[model samples]
Target chain A: MDALIEKLKGQIIEQLNLAEVKPEEINPDSPLFGEGLGLDSIDALELIVLLEKHYGIKIQDPKDGKTIFQSLRTMAEYIKSQGKS
Target chain B: MDTITSYAHIKHNQVSVNGEIIFQSYPSLSLPEFLSEAYKALGVSYPKFHKMDAQCKLGFLCTEFTLNGTSFLTENDITKTAIVLSNAASSLETDRVHQHSIDDKSNYFPSPAVFVYTLPNITIGELAIKHKITGENAFFVSEQFDAGLLVNYTETLIQSGTEASVMGWVEVDGTNFEAFIFLAEKQKYTNKNAIFKPLNKTSVITIYNQTIWTH
Candidate 1:
């Protein structure tokens, strides 16, 4: 679980090019959008692609991604539920 | 009085004015292809072009030809020159890609790589760096081409004793891109002796509004 969270954090940083951000700075349970990580709609699409490419999760609907990508904890739980991790 | 001796341009490697072609070269294959070819022709590294956004690349191409290999003025002379450019889209391509990221949830994250090009001023920044032009730089956006605004601003600079003003219109829509430039200087001449005439604001508004080039 810890390793998966680390991997996810790395991916977020790389995909977003969060220049000043480090992996350790992201809180696993913190919100990934708006308040916490401050990611917007565009970042959400990139994250969705990251899921599909890395974990074989296909997000066919944008609305469904809101719940799944709320935070690292939610994303990790979803990935585990899908037997992806 | 300062005077424009000559003007030159290269679109797809062909220097031209109006419909008259001064020099012609083969058209580029694609955006990437053109960038690569331009980099090679200028003897700059390929990676450098890759690092630059589209607008910067286009601005560089236009400005390089405008200078025509003239030795850039030293720091003391730098204050005498200025750059004034106009564009239609103003980084819409960057905006489009950024909007795409938001429209599609599957791509929930935006790449910072794409975000940096969102501003229209990056082109001017690129031009200043390449040409070492440190005087004045301004970028204006219009609904369509405004030759009068360009001419008037350049004339103002010339009249103020600026050595020269590099002014132009650069517009890109999808795959089509056009750049028109004039290197101007102030001169005392009657209407008949004036090689370049400044169009009145009303005439400019009409021409731009109607998309009429021939007066």
Candidate 2:
């Protein structure tokens, strides 16, 4: 799980080019949107693709993404439930 | 006399497809390469701008060159100078890249870097920060280059009491880029109520070359 989280962090940094941010800077349980990371709608879409590509989990509907992407904890929990990553 | 007292342009050293000089300090480099060279020439080392979209880079380059050495205006003067920029492609390249990211099964995740550039007005934001220009700024996308629209916009700014106006057409895609800027000031006519008239091309060329107006 730790390795998976680290890998996700790396992908996030690389895709977003968050030059000022590091993997450790993102709290695993903290929200990825709003005040936590200040990411916007575009970032959310990018995250959705990241989840699907890396974890082999398909997110067919973007509307369901709101709940699934509420936080890194939720995302990790969802991935664990899917038994993919 | 209200005229373009000074002006500057930076184009790709290499001749572009239409024989138009695409402004760049380095001729051998592509869009990303030329952008890096432009930033280096301007002596800016900030990394925040490195990830900006192509349109933003073009707008920033033109605005930086326009404001680099002007001593007549200070930070306060920016609020009075209107920025009117026209372009042929209104973030089409950005949309293209974004669509590619979504369509390509292998690369389904669109890079945030590319997605942010999809907006046509992002360049305006970049210019505003570089020059601290908070005045009226607009981006117009036209099929072909429209010199009439450019002139009309500048005339409006002049009549509206804008102290100065920076107007131009900047188009860039892949290896193609072109930019032309004119800084204008208000002119007073003795016949105040006379309908505004546009000078002929020859007259414009003469006035541009000589920086003098003649009947």
TM-score of chain A of each: 0.93, 0.86
The residue-by-residue lDDT of candidate 2 on A1-85, one tens digit each, is: 7777777788878766665687899998888888776776877777876777688788988788988887767787788889987
Per-residue C-alpha lDDT of model 1 across residues A21-77, encoded as one tens digit per residue = 788889999999888878767677778878876898987777889899989989988
Please give the range of 10 consecutive residues that has the lowest summed lDDT in model 2 chain B: B206-215
Put down candidate 2 lDDT per residue, B124-149, tens digits, no spaces: 77777766777787888998656567
Best by TM-score: 2
Clashes within 3 Å, all models in order: 14, 7
Off by over 4 Å in 1: A1-85, B12-28, B45-47, B72-76, B159-161, B185-215
lDDT of 1 by residue, B6-90 (tens): 2334455444442245444357466546645654565543223354556667666656655554443332255677878888999
Model 2 residue B184 lDDT score:
51
**Interface RMSD of predicted model 2:** 3.0
For residue A70, give model 2's deviation from the true position in Å: 8.3
lDDT for each candidate structure: 0.65, 0.64
